[model samples]
Every structure is written in C-alpha cells, then in structure tokens.
Target: MESSPQVYVKAPPPPETLGRPFELMDHHGQEVTNASYSGKWLLIFFGFAGCREACPTGLVSMGAALDALGGEAGQVQPLFVDVSMEEPDITGLAQFVSNFHPSLVGLIGTRAQTFATVRDFKIRREYAMANYSTKETGPRINHTAYLYLVDPDGVTRAYFDHTLEPERMALTVRLHMKRRRTSP
Candidate 1:
C-alpha cells in the first residue's frame, strides 16, 4: 500500500451554495463572521501562501471574475484561508497572499484558530513539505484545491472542485447571484 499523491483542482462547476454559513477573516484583519455576510453570497478559497501555483492563479481568476461581475459582483465576497500553522506569525503568508489578490485576505491566529475555522468547514490540510510552518518551522501542506461557495445565510450551497474553468466559475457565481435576486 502506498499513499496517494495530493492533487489540487480549480473551480469545477461546483453545485450551488445558496444558503451556507461561514465565519472567516477579511484582508483588513477584521473579524468577518458568517453573520457579516448575511445578505451576500460568498466565494471562499482555502489555500496556503507558499503555494507555487494554484493559490495565486485561483485568486487571480476569482478577482477577475468579480471585477467582471461589475455591480452584480458586489454581492459576492471572495476569501482566502492560510492552512499553515507552523508559526503564529503569518507575515509571509499575508505578504504572499496580498500580492496576488489585494482583496484576498489571509487568516492567522493560533493553532486553535486554524483548527476551529478549518474544522467547521470540514476542510483538511496535510503538511507534506516540512521546511516551514506557522505552527512549527518548515512544512509543505497538502490541501484540496477545491473552493467552497457559501450562501448569504451561512450555509453550504455548492462546491467548485479543482480544475474548474475560469469563465464557467465566473458565470456560475454570477448565475447564483442572479438567482438570488429573483428569489423572494
């Protein structure tokens, strides 16, 4: 028996997340809870900063999509979570994350903060490269490259798997917002 290689996926036409709750942080180091997004849909990506590719690419596409959404995209809030716990200090991750997507914020606190947030979302991360960690010193993390879309009500509505086409992702998100607008 051998361990399976970790893989990352782009937004893969995830189901609709019309009503899921999520409590995450904003780029401004503010406390952004699920309640904070009570009236808007959310596009959330849980990834690390040291990521060589997927992290930046995903956020970049996501940002572009939001920008493309124009006024409609205002209803959507995109988020990024740093799964690294090697150190309480996330200066590296923060700096790295912000560089890609200025609006894409990174979260950091204690091991408990990471655990509590990740656990609630049912997200998991395995440190493969052990060179540095927010919780320790050096460690590469193994995390799924899936994005979770939560509804305004703070409920799990859909999941965009890895390898999701950018146009499709942006369209899907836009569609969700359009549907929300029509629904009473």
Candidate 2:
C-alpha cells in the first residue's frame, strides 16, 4: 500500500484593523494626528515614562533599530505613546525622550484621548498598587509591550515582541519596506 502525501496550507492573514486615527500632543506641545505622519512608516510603542523596565528596554531597542536602519531611518518615525492617567507634563516628557534616540517622539494626551487610542490599538493595560508611592508617583501601570509597525497609509502591518533583538527588528522593518514598495 502506498501512503498519500500530506499538503500544507498557509493561514490567512489577520484583519488590518489594529490601527486607527488619533489626536495627541507631542513632547513639544504640538498637536498631531494620525494624518500628521502621512507618507512615512511609524513604529509605535505604548508605555509610560515611569515604567522602570519594559518601557526603557523597548525604547532602547527601537533606538538601536533606527540606528541599524541608517539612511532608511529617515523614512521611519518612532513614537512613544504615554499610557499614564495623569495629564502630560511637556517638559518632563521632552526630557525623558531626550535620553533615547534624538528622533524618537513622545506623545501624550487627555485621559479620554489616550484611552481611545489605546482601545483602537487593542492595547491591554492595567494599574497595580505600588509598594511605596508619593503624590508624584502614581500606581504602576502594566501594559502590552509589543512594538507596532504601521504603514504609511495608517494601517498596522506587523508587530514585534518587546524582547526581539534590535538587529532582527531592523531586518523585519526593511523587509516590510521592501514589500510595501513592491506591492500595488
């Protein structure tokens, strides 16, 4: 008796609805919306400046990835969206973002605006009581750490786990950029 060969099937891609329009203020206090980034790819991460580990790790990875991209980095914009409930302090935000890549932009908005953007991005965030805190230090927030890659048209093309290496992340971004150029 002869055995039949098994065939493998590729799975369908996920729906492209993870990205949506948003209006937020940049670290410089300038208002910006999703449309503000038209014609350029966006690498967006959601976290607060106060996050002790994950936020810094993700931002450093993003900065390194940008560096790896070299000239191509100009076509990509890196964004850090604050998830804290408190109103944004532009000075502090500017100072915080200065520590990372010079090109990285930090965004913040009213609580309602932040919530809407977080919901649109399908981010999961929760607040946990800190063992010790002051009026300035609110409860710690735990949130999803995936780095989202959005196309120039404001569509989410892919996402990378926070733990992924910067080199790999740069390669993945390059691959996506190539595909975008080839696709109609």
Candidate 3:
C-alpha cells in the first residue's frame, strides 16, 4: 500500500544535525560515514535487506533511473543505509547490500546508533512478523520506504516516496544537479 505524501516523514535540511556520526561497515567491511561521502551527490535511502516488496522494487527503480543517467551517474552514489537489528556487524550489512546493487554500499551498526541515524534522517519503520527477540513483541521488520537526495555538501535537499515515479525521480535529480552547478 502507498502512503500519503503528507504522512511521510521529512529529513532535516542540509547540515541540520552534525549529530553523532556512526562507523557503519560497508560491503567490504570498510569504514564509511556521512563525511566520507562528501564531494559526491548521495542518494541515501533507509530500508532493510529482508523487506520483500517495498525495498527491492524501490531500489530497482532507482538503479534503472541512475543507469539511465549514463555518465552523470558517476557523480552520484546510491547508498543503502540499514537499520535492521538482524545484522550483527558491518560485514553482514555489507554483504546484504552487495547482494542487490553491486555498486550500492551498505551501512550497518548498533540498534541505538542505527536508530539515531534513521531518526536524524527522519526514516520510519514498522514491525511486521512475530517478535524475533524474546523481549520484543513482534518478529520481522517492515519499513516505510523513503528516498533522500543528499547534496555534495551533505545537505538533504530533495525527498520522494518509495513508489516515486522513475521518470520524475530522474528529472528531479537532473534538475538538482543543474541548480547546484549554476548556483553562486
């Protein structure tokens, strides 16, 4: 099911929260951060690897759109930021992300740290299946998909939904790049 635009959460504007930076492991278990992504446009999204529908389809659309971007996509980075507690370490998250978009990088961390980052980005998730943890009530994690465009300066300037039209997403990214280049 699709969510109303208004019901969707919005990430804070660029540089809004320098916040507590977490050391998330990438696909290779290499260290990465918001700072490490500087100097390139970032298409940062929040969702889990196990999400059966929303996450996979959304990413497929994103990758196809970026591929259509041709060489311009070289300036863009498609990032998979995970908040799932199933991942025990960075390597796990890295492997999970690599399974989809080979070029896509995955970032994973402690629940507290991951949740904090998600909160900063205004990402939202919901419990789906029975609780996997004995202490928790439910099992699987079903997330609300959100797409965030973080500029080279580390500012989140554009936002869209999980089911955002591919053509529109492409147009939006192009327009953003154009504006940034022409700006004083």
Candidate 4:
C-alpha cells in the first residue's frame, strides 16, 4: 500500500464585536467620546482605583508596552477607564493616571455611562467587602483584566490577556499596524 501526504488548512477568525461607543470625562475634566480619538490607536484597560493588584500590574505592563513601542508610541493613546461605581473626583483620577504613563488618560463617567461602557465591553465586574473594611475603605472591585487595542478608524483590532509580556505586546501592535498599513 502507498501512503499519501496530508495537508492542514486554517480558517480565518470571526470578526470581533468586542468594543462599543462610549462617552466619558477625562481626568482633565474634558468630555470625550470613542470618536474623540479618531486619528490615533487606543489601548484601553478597565479597572478601578481601589484595585490594588491586577489594575496596577496591567497598567504598568501597558505603560511598558508603550515605552517599548518607541516612536510608534505617539500614534497610540493609552486609556484607563474607571469601572468603580463610587465617584472619584477629577483630582484623584488625575493623580492615579499620573502614576502610570505620562500620556495615559483616565476616564470616568456617570454611573449609567460607566455601566453602559462596561456592558458594551462585556466586562465582568463585582464588588466585595474587604476583610479590613473601614468607613473610608469601600468594597473592592474585581473585574476582568484584558487589554483592548482599537485602531484609528474606531475598530477593535485585537485584545490581549493580562499576563502577556510588554515586549510581546508591543510586537503584536507593531504587526497589526504593519498589516493595516499594507492592507487596502
């Protein structure tokens, strides 16, 4: 009997419908919509101010990824959307964002707007009373920690897990940019 060689075929991925339109206020108190950042790519992460672990880790990684991008970093706008139900003032949001990248913008919206954005992003979030809860210390928010990459044309190009390395993240973004540039 004679043996035949086998071939493998891969199918294209389904189109993503991950992100949606949002209207929020920046840390600077400026109103912004999804279309506000029309000419630049958006790197967005959703987390709360009270998140002590995952949020900082994700933000740091995101900052490092932007740094790794070097000149290409200017074309990307990094955003940290506050998903907490509690209202944090502009000063606090400004301080929090300053701790991350210089260009990282913190977004906060009304409860309804935040809820809509969270739902649109399909983020799973919950609030749990902390073990060391005090009058000042509120319930901690637990939410999904995925990073979203949105292209200039307001399309979600890709998303990355929290654990991905900064260098790898930058490389992935670079690849996506290259593909977009070369495509029709």
Model 4 residue 48 CA deviation in Å: 0.5
Give candidate 2 regions above 4 Å deviation.
Answer: 1-15, 131-137
Expressed as tens digits, the lDDT of each residue in 1-184 for candidate 2 is 9999999998734527786989999999999998898899999999887776788889999999999999999999999999886878888788878889999999999999999999988888988766434423456787999899998988888898788999999999999999999989
Ranking by lDDT: 2, 4, 3, 1
The better candidate by lDDT, 2 or 3, is: 2
Best by lDDT: 2
TM-score of each: 0.74, 0.88, 0.79, 0.87
TM-score of 4: 0.87
The models' CA-based lDDT, in order, is 0.67, 0.88, 0.72, 0.86
Give the TM-score comparing model 2 with the true structure, all chains together: 0.88
Model 1 per-residue lDDT at 136: 38
Cα lDDT over the full model 2: 0.88
Model 1 C-alpha lDDT per residue in residues 9-51, reported as the tens digit of each score: 7763334422234344544566666677668677777777677
Give the per-residue lDDT of model 4 (tens digit) for 27-122.
999999989998899999998865667888899999999999999999999999999867757787788889999999999999999999888777
Ranking by TM-score: 2, 4, 3, 1
